[model samples]
Target: MIYLDNAATSFPKPPEVLEAVSAALSAPASPGRSGHAASLAAARSIHRARKNLARLFGLPDNSRLVFTANITWGLNTALEGLGLQPGDHVISSAMEHNAVARPLNRLAAERGLVWETAPADGHGFSSPDDFKKLLRPETRLVVLNHASNVSGSLAPAREIKAAVGEIPMLLDAAQTAGALDLSDAGDWLDMLAFTGHKGLLGPTGTGGLWVRPGLALRPLAVGGTGSASESIRSPDFLPDALEPGTANTHGLAGLAAGVEALLKKGVDQIRAQEMKLTGIFLDGLSQIPGLTVWGPRDTNSRVATVSVTLKGYSSSELSAALEREAGVLTRAGLHCAPLAHRHLGSFQGGGSTRFSLGPYNREEDLNSALSALDRLARLKA
Candidate 1:
C-alpha cells in the first residue's frame, strides 16, 4: 500500500531508530532505578533523548522537557497541573483537536472554568488579530495549535504572542515539531506538547511536554520520582516532578535516534520538499470537477496535509473506493477534530478524506492519487 496516513503514525521507521530500540530491548533496564550497568545505560539514553528534544525546539533547559505516554497525557499534565481557580478562562483556536477541547470542556463542566475559542476563517486560519479580541484578564492560559491536523494550515504563534504580551501560552506542536523549524519557540512559549509518532518519526507511546524557566506547575501525580524517595512528596524539580513510574526508555532510545537523524537532514530541507510536492498535488486537484479542496489555497500557510470533499459521495465511500481501486491509503471521517470540521464546512459531509504527506512520499504518489480521484469523481451516482 502507498502509505499516506502519516498524520496518524509514521510507518517504516528509520534504520537508526530501529537499531536503537532493538539495542535497548536486547539489554534492557529501568531508567533511574539502580546504579548497575544496564540501569545506567537506560538513564543515558533517556537523558540524551531529552537533550535532543530541547535542541530541536530551542529549549534552554533540557530537564524541563518531561516525557508522557503521548501528547494527550502531556496536555493533561499541563492543564491539570496549572491548579486553576474557578472562573479562570482559557483561550484556544477553533482548529484545535479534541486533545485540548475535551479537557477544557471537562474543566468547564466540573470546575466552573469557562473557555472561549478564537474562530477560524474558511481556510482554516485563525488570525492573531482575531485571537487578540478574545483575550481577557480572566484568561489563565492561551492555547495555540502550531498547525492544524486537518487542513494543515499554520497558526501564527509568535504573532499571537505579540498580541498576548506576557500571558502564558501552551503550544500544541503535534503537527509541526519535527516537520518544521521552531528554533525560537523558547522565546515566546511558556509550555508546549509534542508527540514522537507523527512528525518526529519515532514510535508510538513516546511524546513529552516542555516548560520554560520560572514556571511551576502543581504535580498532577505525586509518587516515586526515583529521586527524593526519602521524602513523602514528589520533588520540586522537573522530569521527576511530573514523571511517575518506570520510563519508556526503549521508545525514548528510538526517539533520540529519530530527532538526531532529523537534525542531520535539516528541517527546512524536508519542508521545502513537502511544499513542492503539495504544490504539484494541489495543481492537479484544481483540475478535477466537483471537488472542493479545503485549507489555504497556497503553500505559504499550510503543511502537506490536504482535506477534500467530493460532490456526490461521503468521505467514507470515497476513501473506501480509492483504497479498493488505487491501492492508496488515506484517512477519512472526523479525525477527532469535530469542531475543526464544523469550522471548515466539512462536518455536514461526514468529515473529509485527508491526504497527509510525509518525507517519504514522492511526486508519483500524488499523481497516482490525483488520477484515481479524477476517475472516481466521474462515476455515476
Candidate 2:
C-alpha cells in the first residue's frame, strides 16, 4: 500500500528499528525492575536511546527526558503539572491539536486558569507577532506547536520565544521532532512533547517529554519509579519523578534505533528530500481543475504534508475513493484540530484530506498520488 499518513503514524519502520524491538524482547524485561544482567542490559538500551535523543535535540542532560506512552500523555503531564492556580493565564495557538487544547480547556474549569489562543493566518500559520500581542504579564505558560498536524505549517517557535521573554514555553513537537531541526530548542524551550510513532519513525506506544533545567513540574501520577525504593513517597528527580510503573522497553528499543538512524542520515538531508517531494506534489495538485489545495501552497515553511478538497467530494469521500481505487492511504476529517480547520475555512464541510510524507516516500509515490488525484478530480467535475 502507498502510505501517506506519516503525520498520524509513520509506516514501514526502519529495518534497524524492527531488529532492535525483537532483540529487546529476547534480552530482558523493563529497565530498573531489577539489577540482574538481563535487566541491566535493558537499562543500558534505554540510556543509549535517551542519550541519542538528547544529543539530537542538543540537550545537555539526557536524564531530563521522561518517557511517556505517547505525545498526548507527555502534553497532559506537562500541562497539568504546571500547577496553575485560579486566575493564572496560559497562551496557545488555535492551530494546536486537541492534545494541547483539551488539557488547557480542562484547566480553565479545574483551576480557573484562563487561556487565549492566537489565531493562525490564512496560510494556517500562527505568526510570532500575533502571539506577542496576546501575551499578558500573568501568562504563566506558552503552549505552541512546532508544526500544525493539519497543514504542516511550521510555527515561528524561536521568534515567539524571543518575544515571550522568559515566560515558560511548552512546545508540542509532535509533527516536527525528527522532521525538522530542533537542536536550538535546548536554550529557549522550557519543555517539549514528542511522539515516537510519527516523525521519530518508532512504533506506537512510545513517546517522551524534555524539560529544561530549573523548571519543576508536579508529577501527574505517583507510584513505584524503580528508584528510591526505601521511601514510600515518589522521588522528585528527573525521569523518576515522571516515569511510573514498568517502562515500555521494547518500544523504546525500537525508538533508540530509529533516532540513531535519523541522526546518521541527518535531518537536513531528510528535509531536503521531503521538500523536493512537497514542491512537486503541490504543483501537480494546483494544476488539477475542480480541486483546491489547502495550506501553504509552496514548500517553504512547511513539512511534506499536503491537504486538499475536491468540488464534489468531501474529505472522507476522497480518502475512501483514493484508498479503494488507487491504494493511496490518507487521513481525512478534522485531524483533531478543529480550530485549525476553521481557520483554514475547511471545517464547515468536514475537513481536508491530508497526505503526509516521510523518508520512505519517493518521487514515484508523489507521481502516483497526483495521478490518482487528477483522476478523482476529473470524476468530480
Candidate 3:
C-alpha cells in the first residue's frame, strides 16, 4: 500500500525507535519513582529524550522541556497558563487548527477575552504585516500554526513574532517539528508544541512543549511530580511544575532514539529529499485536467503535503476510489482545520484530499499516486 498520510501520523517508524521501545519494556522500570536500577535506567532514558529534543530545537535548558500526551495538551497548557484577564486580546491566524481555535473560543466565552484572527491570502499564507495590524493594547499573546495541515502552507512565524514585539508567541509546530530545520527556534520562538508520532518519527503518546526561560505556565493538573512530595503545592521547577504523575518512560525511550536518528541524518537532508518528491508530485499534478491543486504552488513555501480537489468527486469519494483501485491511502475532509479550509475556499466542498509525503516515501510512491489520480480524473470526465 502507498501511504500518504504523514501529516496525521507517520508510518513505518525507524527500526531504532521500535528497538528502543522494546528495550524499555523488556525491563521493569518506573521513571523517577524509585532509585532502583531499572527505575534509574528509565529516568535516564526520559532525560536523554528531553535533552535530545532540546538540542533539536536549539533550547539551551533541557529542564524546561516537558513531555505531554501530544501537541494538543501542550497548546492547552500554554493557552490556559497565560494569565489573561477579562477584556484581554489574543491574536491567531485564519489558518489555525481547532487546537488553537477551540481554546481561544472557549477563553472568549468563559473568561471574556477577545480573540482576533489575522488574515491570510487565498493560499493560506499569513503575512507579518497582517498580524501587526491586529495588535491591541490589551493583546496578551499571539498564537499561530506554523504550517496548515490542510494546505501545507507555512506561516512566516519569525517575522510575525518580530512584528508582535514582546507579546508572547506560541507556535504549533505539529507539521514541521522533525521535517523542518528548527535549530534557530530559540532565537525567535517563545513557546513551541510538537508531536512525536508525526514528523518526529516516534511512537504515539509522545510529544512535548518547550517554554522559554522566565516564561512560567500554570500547571493544568497538580499531583505527585515525584519531586515535591513534602509539600502539597506542585514543584515550581521547569518540567516538574508542568509534568505530574508517572511519566511515559517507554514512549520516551522510542522518542529519544527517533530524535537521535534525525540528528545523525540531519533535518536539512530529509527536507531536501521531501522537497524533491514534492516538486515531482506537483509537476505531475499540474498536468492532470479537472484536478485543482491547493496551497502554494512553489515547493519552497510549503511542506511535502499536497491537497487537491477533482471535479465530480467529493473528498471522501476520491479517497475511497484511490484506495480501492490502487491501494493508495490518503486523508480526506477538513483535516481538523476548518478555518484553513474556509480560508482556502474548500470548506463548501467538504475539504480536500491531502497527500502528505514522508522521508520513507519513494519516487515510485508518488508516481503511483499521480497515476491513480490521473486515471480517476479521466474516469470522471
Candidate 4:
C-alpha cells in the first residue's frame, strides 16, 4: 500500500537503522549497568546517539539530552518535572495536541494552576502577538507545538520568544524534528520534546528531550541510575535526573544511525522532496470537485501534511476507500488535536482526512495517490 500516514510514524526506515537495532539487541549487556565490555559498548552507543542528537539540535551540551519512550513521555518529563506549584499560570496554544493539553488541563484542574490558551487564526496558526497579550505575570511556562499535527501550520518561534522575553518556552517538535530546520530553535527554547519514529526514521518508542543549561527540574522517576548507588534518591544530574531506569539502548543505537542518515541526506533536500510531493498532491486535489483542502494554500508556510474533506462523505469513508479500494493509506479523524479541528470547523462533522508525506515518498506515489483520490471523488460525485 502507498502509505500517506507519515504523521503517525514513518515507514521504510533506512536499512542501517534496522541493522543497528538488531546488533544492539544481539549484544550481551545493557547500557550503563555494568563495567563489562558489553555494557561499556552499549553505553558508548548510547553516548554516540546522544551526541548525534545534540549536534542535530545544535545543543552545546550532550549531557543535557534525555531519552524517553516518545514525544509524549518527553513532554511529560518537561511539564511534570518542572515542579509547577499551585496558582502558577501556564500558557499554550489552541492548536496543541492531547500530549500537551491533557496533562496541563489535569494539572490546572487538580492543582489550581491557571491555564490559558492563546487563540489562533482561522487557519489554526497562532500569532505571537496574541500569545504575548495572554501572558500573565504568574505564567511560569509556555508550551507550544512547532507545527500543527492536524493542519501542518508553522508556529512563529522567534517571534514568540521575543514576545515572551525569557519566560521558559518548551517547544514540542514532534511534527517538525527531522522535516524542518530546528537547530536554531535550541538557542531560544528552554526544552524541546522530539519523537524518533516520524521524520527521524527511527524505530517506535525512541524519543528525547533536550534541556538547556542552568534549568533544574524535579525528577519524574527515582531509581537506580547506575550512579548514586549508595544513596536512595535519584542522582541529581541532567540525564539521570530525568531518565530513571535502564535506557532504550537498542532504539537509541538505531536512532543514531537514522539521525546520521538524515544528516548525510541533508534536511533541506529531504524537505524539498516532501514539499514537491505535497505540492503535486495539493494541486491534484484542488482540481477535483467537492474536495476541500485545509491549512495554508501556499506550501511555504506549512509542512508536507495536508488535511481535506469531501463535500458528501466523512473523512473515514474517504480514508477507507483510499486504503481498501485504491491501495492508498491515509489517516482519518481529529489527528489527536481536536481543538485544532474545532478551529478549522471540522469537528462539527468528521475530522479532516490527513495525508502526511515523508522523505522516501516519490513522484510515482504522489501520482498514484492523486489518481486514487480523483477516482474516489468522481464516484462520490
As for TM-score, the candidate ahead, 1 or 2, is 2
Once fitted onto the true fold, the runs of candidate 3 whose alpha carbons sit more than 4 angstroms away are: none
lDDT of 1 by residue, 1-381 (tens): 777787888766789999999998888588898989999999999998998888999888899999998998899888888987789988998898999989999998999997999877887688878878988889889898888889999998899988988888999999998888997788778998999888888889999899998878886677787898888877888879999888888899999998998888888988999899999999999998899887887898899899898888789888888899898999999999998998998898789999998888999999999999999888842
* lDDT tens digits, residue span 1-381, model 4: 898889999988999999999999999988998999999999998898888888788898889999999999999888998889999999998889999988998899888879988888888777888888988889899999888988888888778978998799999999999998787766788999999999998999999898898788787677878988889877888788888889998999999999989989888888888888888888888898898887887678889999999877799998988898878899999988987899888888779999999988888888888888888888868
Count of clashing pairs, candidate 3: 0
Superpose all Cα atoms of candidate 3 onto the true structure and report the RMSD in Å to 1 decimal: 0.9
List the candidates ranked by lDDT, beginning with the highest: 3, 2, 1, 4
How well does candidate 2 match the true structure in TM-score terms?
Answer: 0.98
Lowest-lDDT window of 10 residues in candidate 3? 118-127
Scored against the true structure, residue 264 in model 4 reaches a CA lDDT of 90
What clash pairs does model 4 have?
A: none
Q: Mark the regions of model 1 whose C-alpha exceeds 4 Å error after superposition.
A: none
- List the global CA lDDT of all models: 0.88, 0.89, 0.92, 0.88
Candidate No. with top lDDT: 3
lDDT of residue 111 for candidate 4? 85
The lDDT, on a scale of 0 to 1, for candidate 1 is 0.88
